[model samples]
Target: MYLRKMLFILLTFVSAVSLAACSDDENTTAATPTAKANVKVVHASQDAPGVDLLVDNTVAGTNLTFPNNTGYLQVNAGTRNVKVNVSGTSTTVIQANLNLMENKFYSVFAVNQASAIEPLVLEDNLTNPASGKAHVRFIHLSPNAPTVNITLTDGTIVFGNVAFKGSVDFTPLDAGTYNLQVRDAATNSTVVLEHS
Candidate 1:
């Protein structure tokens, strides 16, 4: 009887151990690492020379011209000190703090004249548009240009009354050739015309 009781206790203990091990496996899963953020620099100041983008005092881009963009820089998620400087010069044009979140997209714009340069942080929504559509966003970096209207060459208004240094969200357009025009809103004077 003593030997039988001892064997029964041993079997119960083994069963408990087996169940605990299975429970541990059911509770655990493979952990995924945190995603990184993406940043892009744009030179929007027309009067400023080619500029450099600095993050944490490190050069990220060099010699970017007006309306040019630095595709995307992958960075760890955190706060970053961003600076814009004239290319190859120590003269810092602007300084700002960028709070970067994981798996997000950002555009840093260097706008206005050199003496009073500014940074515009634009958070971009990277959602894919519907089929046969294109995503287009507009920025008004022309400092002296008046509030303008964007239209097709056929006078179809696209963006109405966009002021200097202002911008608009991305709108989906059909895939096709576009003759774009930027005209002064108040006087209807043509400011820019492009065939694309």
Candidate 2:
């Protein structure tokens, strides 16, 4: 009889522990329904002045200049209002509503001339590349520059004729040092060069 009682107590303890663990797991799952999203603001307009970025009317980034970006801003996943204003002025340069998904990444591009600025939102590809490979992407932000080809010093064209405010998809290459050059597509004149 004593042995049976002890067995009953052990079974009850096991059941209680199991129930507690299950309840805790359920609570954890419920608390994590949505994840945060990351957004980057890029200033691509060649002549536009530095600007301030706002999220829900709050200043998220300030003094973002041409051909640059505010690396990444973490925000809750939902519909959001994004606004860009010229620095130290009330002049609103760009305003738009963005629906951001959980755990996603985005880039907001402010492009065109200062008088006629435009906004472009692009979803970033966040997929991981294969092992032993490096991934690279390019954004063409120069307003006056013509369509350009990104080439290696060896004369191999990696990306061709990317227009102003355009971008090239990420391409994977083996790890190595490279000399890259950007040339005007029409005239083949080198505009930018870098070694990496």
Candidate 3:
């Protein structure tokens, strides 16, 4: 009879503990939804002056010079107006209406010479590469540059037939230092640029 009573008490305790666990789970709140996107801006216009980048009329970057970039910044996702104005001035040089979606990444580049500067928007894929690999991408921002191939110094082509303003998608490469060069597509022998 004593054993029966002890078994009954143990069963009751187990039941109460299970119920409390379930109750705690039911009271827990879920994470709130986010309505934001990440944006980065690059100044690729060789002849353009230092500039300010504005999103929805609010300055996001000030005095961004040629070849400089404003790294990823989070902003409200929706129809947003982006503008570039000469630094310390009210004169707007480039503007665009960007329809950004939530949870995505975007890059905006100011390209071409100062006289004809324009914005180039690109969706960015930031997925991680495989283990022991790295991601690389190429963008041809030189306005007058020709179709070209990117190659290793040993002459293996990594990217081919990219023209002016063209961009190569992110590709995985084994992580290591590489000596690379840009060669004309037509002959694949004339070196345009070289980097180590």
C-alpha local distance difference test of each model: 0.74, 0.74, 0.76
Instruction: State which candidate, 1 or 3, has the greater lDDT.
Output: 3
For candidate 2, the clash count comes to 0
Candidate topping TM-score? 3
- Candidate 1 weakest lDDT stretch, 10 residues: 5-14
> Which candidate gets the maximum lDDT versus the true structure?
3
The root-mean-square deviation over C-alpha atoms between each candidate and the true structure, in angstroms, is 22.7, 19.6, 20.3
Taking the tens digit of each residue's C-alpha lDDT, what string does model 3 give over 72-92? 889899999999999999999
Per candidate, the number of residue pairs that clash is: 0, 0, 0
Write down the TM-score of every candidate.
0.78, 0.77, 0.81
In candidate 1, what are the lDDT values of residues 1-196, reduced to their tens digit? 1111100000000111233333354666769876789998877776679988888999998988876889889977789898888899988889898899998989887777767889888887766766777667777776666788888887889878888667778777775678788778888777677554
Q: What is the per-residue lDDT of model 2 for residues 126-188, given as tens digits with 9 covering 90 to 100?
A: 566566666677777656667888889777898888887677766677656778877778888
Badly placed stretches (over 4 Å) of model 3 are 1-34
